[model samples]
Target: MSKGENTRKRIIAKSAELFNQKGYASSSLSDITELTGIKKGGIYRHFASKDEIAVEAYKYAGSIVSGKIHEALDRETTATGKLLVFLKVYENVVEAPPFIGGCPLLNLATESDDGDPVLRENARRGLDNTLELMKRIITEGVRSGEFKADLDVDALATFALSIMEGGIMLSKLDGDNRHVRSNIDSLTAYLKTVAAAS
Candidate 1:
């Protein structure tokens, strides 16, 4: 990459943790400059505004975690296996999150809920897309007879997302992975109950 491109990337990479931890409105250009060691002039040269930087940084963090999820899912062939893999993907989030603070989706979504239209939209987009992916998996599981035909895919998908975010939030708050571990066990047990066959 060109020098300018590399600098821009460095700025985003460094500030992603800052934004995720401190939040967009709370994270000033000064904070970014301090964290990234790139002055206002250099930062402005790459990003038109703090809003732009926040969007890119949020996306950067989201991509890292989501990439891990997809990679793990790719290893599982069955729908039930994929579902288990998905839940297990965040098993280490409390101890070794993709970033320092925690889940980018939860952080940005909660922080941007009452502020930053652009950010709120991006957060919603990410969330909606994830729900759709999970819904698709559940739907396929039903069609393939792996999951019971009567399963409510939409409701289950939404519930699973809630469990994931709630578990992650609790895990982060307590600095313990037991909540996540419990959530995984509960979800796994529930899925086994819904399985079409043993």
Candidate 2:
């Protein structure tokens, strides 16, 4: 990468971290400059505005966590195993998150709900991608006879995502992994109920 490209990435990384922790509205350009050690002019040279930086930073943050989840999912051969892996990844993140703070999608969704339209849309896309992944897995499971034939894939996917995100939020707020672990346990039990006979 060129020097300019490298600098832009550094700025995005630092901004993502700050945005995850302090939120976009609270994190200032000065804070990003301080963290990145790049002057204001340098930052502006790469990003036209804070909004632009925030969109890129949010995408960067989402990719970090999403990449990990995809890796975990790929390791499982069965749809049931893939679902379990998905839940387990979130459980692990409660203890050792891929990014600082917590889940980027959850953070950005809540932070931008009443604020930045760009960020809100980005967050929504991130969430939609996750739901789609889960839906695909469930749909495959049903077709393969690995899961119940009559399962409501879309509804279940939405429920699972909500449970996972809620668990993360509670775990982060309480400063304990038990909350997420409990949710994961519940998810595991629920998955078993949906799984077909061996």
Question: Highest TM-score: which candidate?
Answer: 2
Q: How much is the lDDT of residue 45 in candidate 2?
A: 95
Model 1 Cα lDDT, one tens digit per residue, 14-101: 7889988887778899999998888999999999999899899989988888888899888988877777665677787777876678
In model 2, which runs have C-alpha deviations exceeding 4 angstroms?
none
Candidate 1 local lDDT, residue 34:
94
Q: Write the per-residue lDDT of candidate 2 for residues 49-100, one digit (tens) a residue.
A: 9999999999999889888888988888888778766557767565588788
Error of 1 at 120 (Å): 0.6
Q: All candidates' lDDT scores?
A: 0.86, 0.88
Please give the lDDT score for candidate 1.
0.86
Q: 197 in model 1: Cα distance from truth in Å?
A: 3.5
TM-score of each: 0.95, 0.96
Worst 10 residues of 2 by lDDT: 86-95
